[model samples]
Target: MDMATTESTASTMSLASVTLEVADPEATHRFLTAFGVETYVRLRASQAPSTGFRGFTLALTVSRPATVDGFLDAAVNAGATVLKAAAKTLWGYGGVVQAPDGTIWKVATSAKKDTGPATREIDEVVLLLGVEDMKAGKQFYVDRGLPVAKSFGGKYTEFAAGDSSPVKLALYKRRGLAKDVGVPAEGAGSHRIVLGSTAESFTDPDGFAWEASTSSARP
Candidate 1:
C-alpha cells in the first residue's frame, strides 16, 4: 500500500506495525500468541545459533532461504547476543535466533496462496509525553481545539479530537513519567519518533517532545 501523504490527518492513516526489542523468541512468541497474535513468519531455524522471526506483516512477500543465514551472520557481527537458534516452525516458516537487544527480525514466505485485496484493521498510535508544566500544556491543547477527556493527578492529562476510533494527545510530568515508563527523561528540544500513521508531534513550553497520533498498540 502507498504510504500516507504528508498532509493527511489521523483519520486518513492507520498504524501498520511496531518493531520492538525483545530478549527471548520462544517466550515472546508464546506471549504474543496468547495475547491474540497467531500469525508469524519465521526467518531462521531453531538449530542455528543466531536467528529471528516476523510476528506480523502488513504486506505479504516471498521468503528467501539465503536471506536467513545472511541476517544471522550480520546480526552476530554487529554485537547481538543470540537467545534462540534458527529453526523452522511447524506452521511452515523459518525463525532464527533471538537477539539480546529484544529485537526479533523474521524472514518468511506468505502462507496465503491467492492474491487478493488486503483486509485488516489498523491500530491507533499513542504518544507518551513529558512536560515541564502540565497545567499550561493542558490549556494549550484545550485552546487549540483539542478537548481533555481524563486527568490523572495534576501531572498527567489526555486530550482528543472527536472521532469514531479512539485517538488521543496526552501530557505528563517529565521525571515522574520517565520513571514510570522506564525511559530516560528528555531535557529539552525536539525528539522525533516516527510511526506508520500521519506525522505529528507535541512540544511542551520547555521544548520537550510528545508523540501525537493514534498508531500505538497497548498490551
Candidate 2:
C-alpha cells in the first residue's frame, strides 16, 4: 500500500463505546444491570433539556425468539415501559421498550422459533441514529472514514466496525425510525447520547456528538 493509504487505513475511525447521558447515573446503572446490558453502555449525569423522542434507539439482536422475550421481560421488569410487545413479524420476533431514563431499546431475533432454551446471550448491539436526511447522514459518516457495511437505498445505512468493537453504528430516517420504535419524530434539544470513537471529536450533520475514545473511558 502507498504511504498515504497506509496512514489513512491506520487512522480509520472505529466506534469504541457509547455513553448514555441520563439524570440519575446510579439508577440507570442499576436498571442496565438488571436488564443485562450494563457493560454495553456507560452512563453519566446530564440534565440537558430533551423531550419526545431522542432521535435514536439502541438495539439488541439475539439468537432466537425466546431470547427476545428474555430481554424484553427483563427490561420491563427493571423500570422500562413497553412500547411494543414481543411479536412475530415477517422478518422475526421483537419488541420495544423505553427505559426510565428515556433511552429506547429494541430486542429482536431473526429466528422464527427457538431451538433451545433462552439465555442471556446477546449476538449484537447496534446504535441506530435517526437523522433528518438519509443521504446527508450517510455521506457525513462516509466522509468521516466509516466504511459502509450495508445500504438500503436512501432509507438506511450501516457502517463497518472491528470485530471487537462494542457497538455497531447505523443511520435511518427519523420519521421511519420513530414509527418503528413507536414514538413521534419531533424532538429537540440535546440527543443526550455521546459516541466514543478512535478519531478526533466532531459533531455529525444531525448533531450527534463524537468524542475521543479516551474521554468515554473516564469514570
Candidate 3:
C-alpha cells in the first residue's frame, strides 16, 4: 500500500451498527422481528420528512438459493413489499423488498441451487449507500479513515468491514443503486438512516449521518 492507503488503513473506521429512523419504531421493530433480521438493524422513532427513495439499501447475503427464498418469504409475510421476486440471475439468486418503514433490503446468494434444506443463516450484511458522485463519495470515506476493500472503478466501492463491525459498507452511483433496487432515483429530505461507528459524528456528502458509537442502539 502507498502512503495514503497505508494512512487510511491505519485509522480505518468500523461501522458498528445501522439505525433506521422511522415514524413507528414499534411497527418497524415488529416487522424486523418477524422478518428475522431484527438483530441486524436498530430502530428509533423519528418523524423526519422523507420522500421517495432513501438512496440506500441493506443487503443480506446467504449461502444458498433456499436461504434467499426463506428471507424473501419472511420479509413479505411481515408486510414488506416485494420489489423483485427471487430469481436466478447471471451472478446468483436474489430479490428485493421494501419494509413498511421504507427501507429497502436485498437478499441474495451465490449458490445457484440449494444443496440442502433452507436455513436462516446470513453470511453477511452490507450497507450500500447511493451517492451523486462516486469518486467524491469514495474519497470522503477514505479521508474519514475507511480503507477500500474492493473497487470496481467508479461503478462500485466496498470498504473493509472490520471484524468488529455489524455490517459492511459500500458505495454506488445514486441512480444505479436506486434502479438496482427498483425505485426511482429521486428523493428528498432526510436519509432516515444513521450509522453508528467509532468515528466522530458527521454527515457524508450524500447526507448519510454517522454518530459516535455511544448510543444504546444495538441491532
Worst 10 residues of 1 by lDDT: 52-61
Show where candidate 3 strays beyond 4 Å. Answer: 1-8
**Per-residue CA lDDT of candidate 3, range 1-219, in tens?**
212232236655778888999998999989999888898888888999999999999999999999999999999999999998899998999999999999999999988999999998889999999999989999888888888888777778888887667689999889999998888999999899999988788899988999988887635
Where in model 1 is the C-alpha error above 4 Å? 1-125, 164-167, 186-189, 194-204, 208-219
Winner by TM-score? 3
Please list the C-alpha lDDT of all candidates, in the order they appear: 0.40, 0.87, 0.88
Best by lDDT: 3
RMSD of 1: 15.8
Q: In order, what is each prediction's RMSD in angstroms?
A: 15.8, 5.2, 3.2
**Model 1 alpha-carbon miss at residue 24, Å:** 23
User: What number of clashing residue pairs does each candidate have, in the order they appear?
Assistant: 27, 0, 0
TM-score to native of every candidate shown: 0.35, 0.93, 0.94
lDDT of 2: 0.87
